[model samples]
Target: MGIVIKQSIKNTIITFIGFGIGAVNTLFMYPYFLGEDYFGLSGYVLSAANILYPIMSFGIQNTLIKFFNENNKTEHELNSYITYMLLIPLVFIIPLTGLFYFNYDTIAAYESQKNPIIYSFVWVIPLIAIFMGYFEIFYAWLRAHMQSVFGSFVKEVFVRLLISVLLFGVYFKYITPLEFIYSLVFVYGMSLLLIVFYANKIKRIVLRFKVPKQSKAIWTYTIFIILSASIANMLLDIDKYMIKHYMDIDNIAFYSVAIFIAMVISVPSRAMHQITYPITAKLMSEQKWEELNELYKKTSITLQVIGGLILVGILVNINQLYLLLPKEYSQGLFVVFTIGLSKYFDLILGNNNAIIFNSKYYKAVLSLGIVLVLLIVLLNMYFIPHFGLNGAAFATLIAITLYSLAKLLFVVLRMKLFPFTYKTIVALGVVLISFFAFYYWDFSFHPMLNIICKSILVSIFYLGLCHVLKISSDINFVMRSIFNKVFKKQ
Candidate 1:
């Protein structure tokens, strides 16, 4: 818990810095500098690549974490394991590359049916996908060694800061829109290189051709992971892809802005997961059920308290935040609310995903993910036509809510574990009370100042209530430490 708390707090700070930069980019630069059409095009290209990278990596990223800490393995066996992780993705990447090369024009034509500018950038998808795939692979390698802060910095801060520079290049008339789009390939490639370098510095990656004794289990897990991961990514990015087909490309940009706001709620979950995932894997592998259940509750409440504050802050200040955006972008307010609620639900699940993925019943969860993807796609098709951007968001909310519930039930029923207690209920109460209390009480000032004042108010009120209620001792401990440092300085 000490290392988890220490690294998670560091990762949280790093992630916030990254998201701050990202908020500037997503909320301001992309919209104003690039214009809506190219912004939408950029969003489309990235979404399509996100959907593809899971298959390209062949699930080696996840497999690396799950299998890396196998007990009683010699140095030679470990090297062999790492070697297999390195080489397995080539099985999918090579064939896919050849396929894309031969049928490039036909695929481009299909993608460009609704949005023609997308035709020229079609080839960039697989190139960036390759970069993203290996980046995750190397990041997972670091996580296996219980080293994630540098990778977090690289991923959360480094790549985004580069993108900001590229955005500025466009603003200063130095790069064409097409060049900016193409520059993303270089950005992701550099990110991959940095993570790979850092991973090697931690442990030199040696390639040994000999397969481990658990080769059969490894292959089985990898195959399941590939299918499961593909389905999961589809559930996330499919709405954007569907939007490109059904709506104007500019609509993707509008929806992306709202989605970005909603995504901030998940930052705590993301920061904590980087550390908890490998720990969850280790515990399950060792069959430490009691310790695993305790971690489950602790992570759930901790994330809930942190994530709830973020959600409440966003909801209460959503109107003022939108006033800062272009009028056309305000159409996504419902999108923000709908998706924000869904993301909050996901945040409260703690390490539910890690538990399911590492458990033997992972196949069942994979089947459930497949069904949810189909459900989301169908809902998007039906709703986007009738309701537009809000429709896509609503469909996502339904699918994600159902998906979260399914995972929760599967974990509880199968493993007889749950991630709730009285504190969970108290956290929810505090969030709801804060939202209702501050939502309609905006100050009569400039929108930026109003947001600042209101956000501070919400934080103090939210954290104050959490402290009084003792919702999370971990969070309370952190708060006391900060106060102690501040008063000592004074």
Candidate 2:
């Protein structure tokens, strides 16, 4: 536990650094410098890349994890499988690139505020997708082998920092916004090379260039996993694409802004999930069902506590948040709750999807993922027409909660495991108390200053409340052990 905390502290610091740059880029500079419409365009371009992501890669990312860890697949066999998997994108990439080259003008013919540079980069999407897929799989390989911090830092921290530099060039007029945005796709390609380098530095990921023998059963599983992953990604990202057709770019910008902030609610859980994955895999390898169950409950509560604080902090002071943004972004306030709730539900279901994916019941995961995607689309269709962005928000909230609850229900019934307990409610109380305390107090300062001050006040109140509630006892036990080691060294 002490070791986990030491490592988690480092990961958390780096993750927050990434989040800081991302928050500034997405929320402030993108909105302030690029303007709402172009910001929306930027959002759309990234969304389109993500939407194409799972398709171009052909589930190679997931296939790598499943294959690499299986002893039956020799190191050479694993490399061959991965090599074939990476090449799988060529099948779609050739056609997609040709399509873009021939019909780009026709494809870019939307009501979008036109930029020829953007269309030029449309070809980069499939190319970038090919490498991004390989990059993610390579990162996952590092993860499976219990080297999560570097992978997480590379992913959550470094990539976004590089993006901030690119955007800074645009803001300073050193590069045209078009060039800056166009370079965005290339950043992904660059990231792939970095990941490959890091993975090799840690332990050689054999890169044999030949296909391996796999039975008919393996192909069936591979196909199912790819289709399942593709469908699931569509559910997450299709909203951004659909908004372009039904609404204006400014509205899309606002919705994207709101979702971006709301996603901050889920970052801690996401970072923690990376570290938890290989540990979960280790348990699965050993057939430690009871330990796995205990870990699940602990992991869920830890995420819920952290996630609950974030959601509470955001909602309680969202008015002040909008005060910092431009007037057009004020409309996003109502949607923040919906988006925040969606991420909250996802956080509470910590590692559930990974658990299912690692288990023999993975087919159920694919089937359920498809069903959830359909539900989200149907809900978005119904809501986007009537409520506009707010409607989209409600639809997202409903879809995410429903999707998460379904996974939780599956885990409970099939595996006889549930992650709720009295400790969970206590943690919720701690966050809620801090939320109201910081929210209601008047801080005589600038909006940015108020933001910083309010955040500090919240932290102090929350930590103080933890002490009063005896949560400090459990935490101190961990801290004391950490310091004991330091003292002995001294």
Candidate 3:
């Protein structure tokens, strides 16, 4: 766990810094600088592209991690394997490119029925999708080599920083709204290039046409994962995409702000998963069930503790935080609460995704993901027309809850492993207690001050309780280490 902790802390810091910049962009710059309509348009374009990139990449990103292991493969075999990873995506990318080129008018018309402004940006979707697809493939390549920090920085910090600069460009009238939208293609393209350069520096990618022995299994997993990845991405971005059908494009911007607030709860999980994912894959590959289960439990509680603090902090300070946003944007309060809760549920699952994806029963889980995507789409279809933005949040919460439970049950039943323990219950107790304790009481200070004060109170109360109850020894150790260092310096 030494390397895990060391890297996770670094990744956590990096992710938070990224989210900090992202918070500014999502919360302030996009709203104020670009105005709501273009902000929503930008959000819509990116969401659409996110939904498409998995199919374009053909799941090579995840496949790389699941398969790459130095213990089992020679350098030649590894090169052949990576060569296959590179080529498989072209099989999808080329056909999709041709389809988009020929049928773009039809595609654009269908998507932009409610918002004609979206039609012009439709071509950019596949272009950015191509960039995003390759970026993840290369990022996965780095993670396979257990070198994720630089890639994490590139993904989390670098991309958001570029968005900030671009948003400022829009602010100063240096870039037209359309130019700003088009610049996204260049931003993601440059991002992919940076990751590719770093990946090459780690190990020069060599092309070898020799087919790996596990070609059969590899293709099978890739096919299922492509569908699975597509479904997963759809589940995330479909609400934003579908919103255009039921609501104004500006509503997407409102919904995105709330979603971004909720998404901060996921940063710790994202940071930890970068390191833990490949580790989980290796553990499962080695058939080290004991260590695997132990890791499962530790990661669950640790993330629960960290994610819980963020969730509690957000929920308790939500009202004051919303006060800081434009009055129109505050309509997403329920969206924040609902999606924040769902994200917290997801965080507590620890490396559940990594475990399941690396397991043999992945095909079954993929089926569940398909059902979830359909369910979410149907729910959004029915709910959005009636309840508007909150309805989308409701649909996501329900779909995520049901899907998370199903995955948990499948893992327990199939593998006889569980992520919960007595500590989990204690951690939940701490979270609930902290929320109830601080939520009803707020300083009569400025909204920002109220949020800062309330957040500090919530953090102290929540983390202090965790320390007392010992919800996660890993967290407690870090807390103690910080305290010891502070006192020593004094």
Candidate with maximal lDDT: 1
Q: Give the C-alpha lDDT of model 1.
A: 0.93
In the range 109-200, model 3's lDDT, one tens digit per residue, is: 99899989998999999999999999999989988888889988998999999999999998898998889999999999999999999999
TM-score, predicted candidate 2 vs. hidden true structure: 0.89
Instruction: Give the alpha carbon lDDT tens digit for every residue of 1-490 in model 2.
Output: 3434455566766787788888898888888777776787777777777777777766766655555555334677766765666676577767877877698677765423343334555555666666667777778777766677887777777788888887778788888767766787778878888888998888676667776665354456566777777765675677776776667766778988898888888787767776677677667767899988877887777677667767877876787888888888889888888888778878887678767766777787777777778887888888888889898888777777777888789888998878877777787778777776666765777877777777776766765565566543435454567679999999
How many clashes in each structure? 0, 0, 0
Against the correct fold, how does model 3 do in TM-score?
0.98
Window of ten residues with lowest summed lDDT in model 3: 69-78
* Ranking 1 against 3 by lDDT, winner: 1
Model 1: per-residue lDDT, tens digit, 159-258? 9999999999999999988999999999999999999889999988877898777778888999998888898788778898899999999999999999
Q: Which parts of model 3 have CA positions greater than 4 angstroms off?
A: 70-72
Q: Which residue runs does candidate 2 get wrong by more than 4 Å?
A: 1-7, 72-78, 81-85, 88-106, 110-121, 209-218, 467-490
Query: What is the Cα-based lDDT of residue 393 in candidate 3?
Result: 98
Model 2's alpha-carbon lDDT is: 0.73
Worst 10 residues of 2 by lDDT: 110-119
TM-score of 1: 0.99
